[model samples]
Target: MYLQTTIIAIIMVATFALASWKLKSPEISMVITAIVGALVGGFGFPSRLLVEGMFTYFDVGMIFLTASIFINIYSETGAMNALVRWIVKQFYDRKWLMLVLLGILMIIPGALTGAGSVSIFVVGGLVASVMSYMGFSKRRVAAFIYLFAMLAAVSPPINLWAMLMAAQANMPYVGFNVVLLVPIVIIALFTIVYTGTSKTPERKSKEHILSELPLPPEGMNWFKIITPFAVLLVLILLSKFAAFSIPVLGLPLTFVICAFASAMMDRKRWDVRKWFDVMVKTMDQVFPLLATVISVGALVNIMTATGVRGLLAITFITLPMVFIYITALLFAPFAQGALSYGSAIILGTPIIFLFNSVGLNVTVTAAALSLLFPLGDCLPPSRIVGRLTVETVGYEGSYMSFLKAIAIPWLFMGAIGLLMLIFPNQLDFLVVY
Candidate 1:
């Protein structure tokens, strides 16, 4: 039974990979794979299992939905454009400084919201024009923006993947901050420097660059422009240290408050119909991801029900500890079909348990795994961020260009994962108690 079930699970996984690679629609692939797995395993369609799986991530789906709405309202206020214009004006003559700041700015929305897709549309879209003005190619700008956005999505305070991993391991989400900070800083610096050095043939033309930036609206209120993000950051930080819990999820709550504030501040310009339209479009864009989350839940349920996860764990137990460590690092990047959160919960939970059984620190192992999970965001088939980057930056070329541009950062992050694996003891300082 064990062997047969294991084979069935492997086939199911292979089907998912093939579908994701060939069909390029992880949501469809996962749903289809779940149904097929159920039949093959005599689980008989698994209606309850499918419903349970989808509902498991219902809160996360809410976060994405509300967060997208909030960002849409915020963007409609013209604040994002105003902020970009202000930054360009402040560092108009200092091209390198402007680029560095712009990269950092690109990271903020994702870091705050824990959604790279939101950040890509909110910030990545605006920075494309700025980077172009500074003489960087569209491909390079796209790669840079996408890399930072991914980093922010997984960064501390609100990183969806880290939050899910910590919950799965029964650890506090706050604990990940210490371990994640190092890699985040390292990657951010690398991005800043790389963007600073990238120059186009039009490098020397400050006048041309200035001419290209969109002018902030006449009578633009900087206070209104900064308020929404300010409210969001304060609420998130307070939730972490304050004694009280906010109603609903902290993330969605923060977004709601900010969205309301933004709408009030821009009352004159705000149109309910327009805002609703944008919200609908955002939902349309994010539906695939939301569906993939549900599919992941179903797939994980099927694996657990068939005892495949247990068999896989036992198989790993027989391997040398060192080999197991290396395997986890390598497998981390390809674990997620299309979404990082799904991959973290499904594949990451088991890997953490595997490492814990070997007497390794679960916290350190989980941190390392979490760091490596986002690399999958750049890999082929469902390369979520890669496709988003190309589209947002208006890159005319293939998705491969975005991947190639981000290769160095990807390898750098992978090396960190390997280090955490090989030197868990030395890196034990990163573990939260």
Candidate 2:
């Protein structure tokens, strides 16, 4: 049975590669892989499994979709523009402080939404403009956008990779706030500093840069800009702190409420027609990621039903500790490169179970593993985040050059993830759940 399952798995991999190569769509590639796996496993077109699998992460997809809508609405209010302009006007001359502030700014969208693409979409272009004003090259701007956005996706509140693995392993997705927050902040800041200092280009005058930034629409103010996020924070806190007293709105509804609140703040810009347009635009932005999520669920369902998941888990559990470490470092990004979020279920859950069997703190291990997955967002086949970052930053450089630009921070982030995995117990104190 093990041998048969392994063969099926290999065939699935080959099919995924071929589909990805031919279709160039990770979502479709994964669906094709799932169908082929089912056929090889003798399931012969299991319609129920296919449908059930596709909906496995339906809640997650909703969170992403609603969050995208929320962000689009927020951006439509000119909040994002006002915020970026405020940052530049306030600290553009204080280079280090400005870099740090910008890093934190980039982190917020993805941290809230658990989709790095949101960060790239909502704030990336604005931040890229700021980076260019500092005389950084387009390649550097792209690297900065990708790296911070990646870390943002790894941050607390909505780390999708960690959340998915935890759900798969029957672990609650709590206690990750501190576990994810500390390391992500440190790494994000370091990435910002490292990338910001590379060129040290002559700083453009504040007046010139400010003039170049988009003028925030009339009626924009700090109160209008800050109110929506404040509402989001309050809702999230209420859900966590007063769970029993309040109805459970979940992240999706919370985002929906916040979207309405944000739209209310800028009524002049947000009529019903405007809201519909933003919804359509957001759906267009989110379709690829939503499709990837659905396809990953289907593929994982097929793997589990066919014993392929069990075979992989047993194989991982039996590997030497050192080899497991190597796999965490090496296979993670490659898998993610090919599979996108599918890597979380395909590899991350098994590794978490393996670590749990060995007395490692599963929360810490899961959190650590989340750090490694986004690095693959820029790699081949999918290159989802990388492609978005390049386009958002208008990077016309060679793809290889862009990859080379981010090499240092990428390795640095990977090293941090490996350390967290190796010393999960030591990091256990960070878990507050």
Candidate 3:
């Protein structure tokens, strides 16, 4: 049984690593994954293989695929341009203001949409040109954008994790977010102060900075730019209020709104056929990530199915909570965030249930996980934050310096996390969903 589960874990993780770290094709990875699953079942090499059933594998893929399609559609449409222009123009004159504002903007939409990579890429690319002229360090920008995805993790309206988990618990997401906003804000501000106000030498520019980064072609307007996203926001908020209920269409609904908005925004620049073509370009860049997410889900599902995840559960029992939370805190951005939120829930929930379940204190762990996961999302090679920030901002990918800028800021957050540990009940102030 152990052997069979291990095989699935190996196959699943291998596919994910290949797709992400190595930048391999998703089709190839999926094929490889299915083959491995086939061998595991057909040859009966691992007797326990069947235990990791189809439902687990299929559901993970569906959720991930559905989510990606939504993001993909948005990317293809070019609606993200308005957001870029709006943000750059607002922040160009004030570097510190831009830094804080960028983090805030990233947090709001990202949290609402649960679109981490997509949102970060959009913001990063748009702001790159502006940042280059302004002279912020690469590391600072990288860390800044890295947190860009994270701020969403805790923010309201979107609260993807909360929505996913809340459905199971039958709780109100808005209520949860409202209650925890203070702590989340504290964590977020800590991240901002840590990552935004870096120690790296500030590379202020001598040449007069431009009044604004290049706007999208003449036709784009703020209304056209934000209308789709606004619809999405309204729908989610209405759903929360019982005024309306949104379908569980994952991300497609939002993407559709954005896609049409994209067309509306770029009518002169691109026709329908050309617009659809942009999605293909988007897929070339994004599909692999979806594949990676699905593969990781498969691996984790298999592990849980085959009992390897149970082993990990057993391992968690031996470690002190401090070590667990702190370690997770220090390095989650490299894990690509958002996803780690799930892992922490799966891993931490059990311990909490084991220790004493059924309360908001579980939220602290969730809070701690929330804090850590974004850090993982921003780390390098994966280049979660820096790479996209540099690319989005239209630079030569020199955002490494921005990462250095946040070193001090990270410590400050770390300090806060450490302080939180002293008060056992304070964790409840963090969000669980």
Candidate 4:
């Protein structure tokens, strides 16, 4: 049984590594790997497993779809642009303040959408440009954008990986948020200090900062700029604190409502056809992620059905708790390719169970695991976020330079993960009941 399970694990890892290294689409790679696993394990019909996997994350897919549309509509309304311009104006001539505000701006979209790419493509790209014009190196700009976007993806109200890890551990999603706060704050401060203080080439003209700013539309009501985000925040708070129950739909409904509200606030009228068009475009951006999620489900089903997951869990149980914790911290990042959540579902779930079995605090372990996974977001070979950062910053194939820029932030977070592992009680105060 161990031999068979090990072989299955090897095949799965090889498939993921090949996809990451070769730049093959993760969705296709995962689906094909699932088929191969089923065949090797003699799991009967692969199609059944595939459907089961896809169905497992149907609601998550809906969230991604609606959230994508929300971001698209919100961006189209120029709210983000107005917000950026306003912040830059407020912090004008204050370099540190501007950098700090830029970091916060980069974080907002990802925090709302729970996708690093959304944050990167939506606002990180613009921030990169503005910072470049402000005289920061391409590498520094890429690092700043990558760090904050990653921070946003892992933080607060909509972190998909935290939600997944919590669910797998049978913990409430709300409960998990508090435990994450300390690390989030640490990483954020470190990022701001590190990137904000780095010396870069000085801009020839300070006036160009304002000149390069994205102007809000004519007759635009600046007050209305806050509406979409405000509404979304209120809904999220009400959902969490007020026990507000919107029957048959929850957060996804909030996303849809916010998207509509944002569209309505736009200076340009968006008819139903236009709304449909935006949604289609949003889905085009969202489908690859959705496919990857579903494929991960299929892979999980195969692992569980084949008894491989159990065998792996038992194998981990044999290790020293310290070794288990360290291995998970070091190895989980590489296990994550373009699919952070998928990696969580695969590598994270089993190890989480093992941690629980060995008497480690499941909540702390889960949170630490969440921290480690984002390292994979920019790790070499598959560096999806790093590549996107380079392109957005116009580093144009400077992947290595981008990696170098992000190295410190990555190591800092890794050290935090290690601390969490070593001093789990230090975070006990933040534990949710």
Candidate 5:
């Protein structure tokens, strides 16, 4: 059974490799892999199983999709622009504080949505513009955007890698807030400050900076901008503190509510038609992500049904501890590059289980592993976030140069992940569940 399942897993992986090579679509490649794996496992045309599997990440998909919608509406309403301008106006002279605030801004969307790509889309361009004015090279600007966006996705509340693994392991996705937040915050601050500083740090005049930024729409203010997020924060806090009294608005619904409030608060009111158009655009923007989530779910189910997951799990658990650590540090990102979030289920789940078996804290371990996953978003096969960052920042330098620019911070983030894995027990107290 082991040999057969191992071969089946190998074939499925080969199928994915071939399909991804030819198709250039991660979701399609994964779906094809699932179909092939099921057939090879002698469950030909297992329609019911395939369909059921697609729903595995349904909740996760909705969270990203809805959160993205809120982000889009917030951007559309000029709140995002006003907020960035406000930050620069207030703190551009403070250099380090401004960079930290900007880094935090870049982190917010991805943290809310659980995909770094969201951060790149919503704020990468704006942040890159600000960084450019600070006299950073184009490559460094792209690297900063890519790095914080990566950190944002790995941040708390919506870390897809950790959430995916937790769901698969039947672990409550609680107690991870502080465990994930601390290291990510540190890494983001360090990366931004490190990149922001140079031999001669150029501080653009405040007038020049404000002039470069897109003007906030007429009637746009911080109050308008702050209200929607305030609503979101209050709702989330209420749900946690007043669980029985409040209807449990899941993340998706909560985001939708925020999106609606954002639209309503718009100085330029969105007509129903405009809202519909925005929703449709949001769906179009998020379709690839949603598709990837569904395909990952299907692929995981197929692997489990064919016992491929078990085979891989057993193999990983039997490896030397040092080798396991090496794999987490090295392999996790590449797997993520190839398979996107599916890598978390395929690789992360097994590693988490293996660590848990040895008494490591699952929350810290998962958070550590998640840090590595985003690094892959900047690597090969499908360098989704990487490519987007380059395009967003208009980095005309060689891709290698961009990679080189981020190399230090990338390794720094990975080292932190490795340390977390090594001392998860020590860090376990950070878990606030």
Candidate 6:
């Protein structure tokens, strides 16, 4: 019986690894993994526990997806094109003494809308085309673009990551706040400075550069293009945390307002039909993620109800105290946060709980892991940011070269990790688990 339980657990973990390696739908694999685990764990495993966990995680995932889809629809309309186009012109034409500024600005699009496939298709395509013309390497370009993009994916207001963080820690929204943002910001700055210094000077002369850069909108106001995106984000934030509450519709109203704004962006401002269509499209994109999260709950429920997870937890805690504790903290994130942003956010919950049980401050441990394990969905292989940058004018290469470009950012993110571990100040703003 014990051997059967062990095999079930092994299959569950193997499912995650193989799913990612083969690039399958992780949730589907997890579902299959759970069924297998349930069979091996026997009839004693409580079905009610699995049902409760599934509903809880699934509902959480649903709320986030709903919020994001509402925002995505609002931002993707070409109405916002004017603002994006204007920013592009201004950024390219500006007098710049440093390469770091360019990198930092690159991530803005991903940060704003959310880094899902469709959004990336729109945002990354534009950034890549511009960087190609500007003599910036695509490798260098992808690095800057994805860092901010991933940051946007994980950050607050629309932070699906925060929900997972909260769920894992068994804490509330107030616990996360902007405190976690500090370490991330610190890492980003450090990566920029380090990466910029090593590269050869970027002197393409104003005459050469300006000619290549596109012009800002002729008559279009910047606000018109950006106002919808800005207003929607602001409205979402206000509804989420601000003390001033709207008595009428409440929190869901944030999505409603943003969706309305997005709908308004259409020059023709088509009928309700188009808006519904967008909502449908959003659902299509979100389903796989939904499935994966639900399956994870089932798997966890089975493991825990059978007493296997608790046993494994104790076994892990039993080794030499320091090494055991630190090792457990370290590997948990990798297991949970593997390449997909949605999955990482979903799985990171369990890892957070395990860390908290060990007496390490949940915030410090989470902060440390967040710093160490980046590249959730769209980052480099080694989790190193520097490997992704480019020294050459126009060159792209194998996976290895891509990793090199992102190398600096990885190092920078790591430094932040070290600080999170050692800094006494960590206790100050930390969300107690």
Instruction: Find the number of clashing residue pairs for candidate 1.
Output: 0
Model 3, span 92-189: residue lDDT tens: 55656776666665665455445466566545554444554555555555555555565564555454444434432333433456434665577667
Give Cα-based local distance difference scores for all models: 0.73, 0.89, 0.51, 0.75, 0.88, 0.52
- TM-scores vs. true structure, each candidate: 0.90, 0.98, 0.69, 0.92, 0.97, 0.75
lDDT score, candidate 1, position 210? 61
In candidate 1, stretches whose alpha carbon ends up further than 4 angstroms from where it belongs are: 204-207, 244-249, 337-340, 431-433
| Model 2, runs deviating above 4 Å | none
**What's the alpha carbon RMSD for model 4?**
2.3
What digit string (tens of lDDT, one per residue) describes model 2 on residues 1-433? 7789889989988998899999998889888888999999999997999999989999999999998899889998888899889898788888888888888889888988898988988888888888888988886677789989998899888999999999999999989999888888778877877776777556689899999999889989999998998999999889889999999898999999999999899887667789789999999889988998999999999999999899988888888889978777789998899989989988999898888898889999999999999899999988989889888988888889889978888998999999999999998999997
Point out the worst 10-residue segment of candidate 4 by lDDT: 240-249
User: What is the C-alpha local distance difference test score of candidate 5?
Assistant: 0.88
Worst 10 residues of 5 by lDDT: 196-205
Index of the highest-lDDT prediction = 2
Can you write out model 5's per-residue Cα lDDT over 1-433, one digit (the tens) per residue?
8789988989998999999899888889999999999999999987988999999888999899999999889888988899999898888877788788889899889888988888888888999888888788886787789899898888877999999999988898899899888898788877977786654266577899898899978998778889999999999999899999988889999999998899888735788888888889888778878998999989988888999988989988898889977777679889998999999999999888899899989889888989888899877788999999999999998888889988988999999998998899999889997
Which one is best on TM-score? 2
In TM-score terms, candidate 3 sits at: 0.69
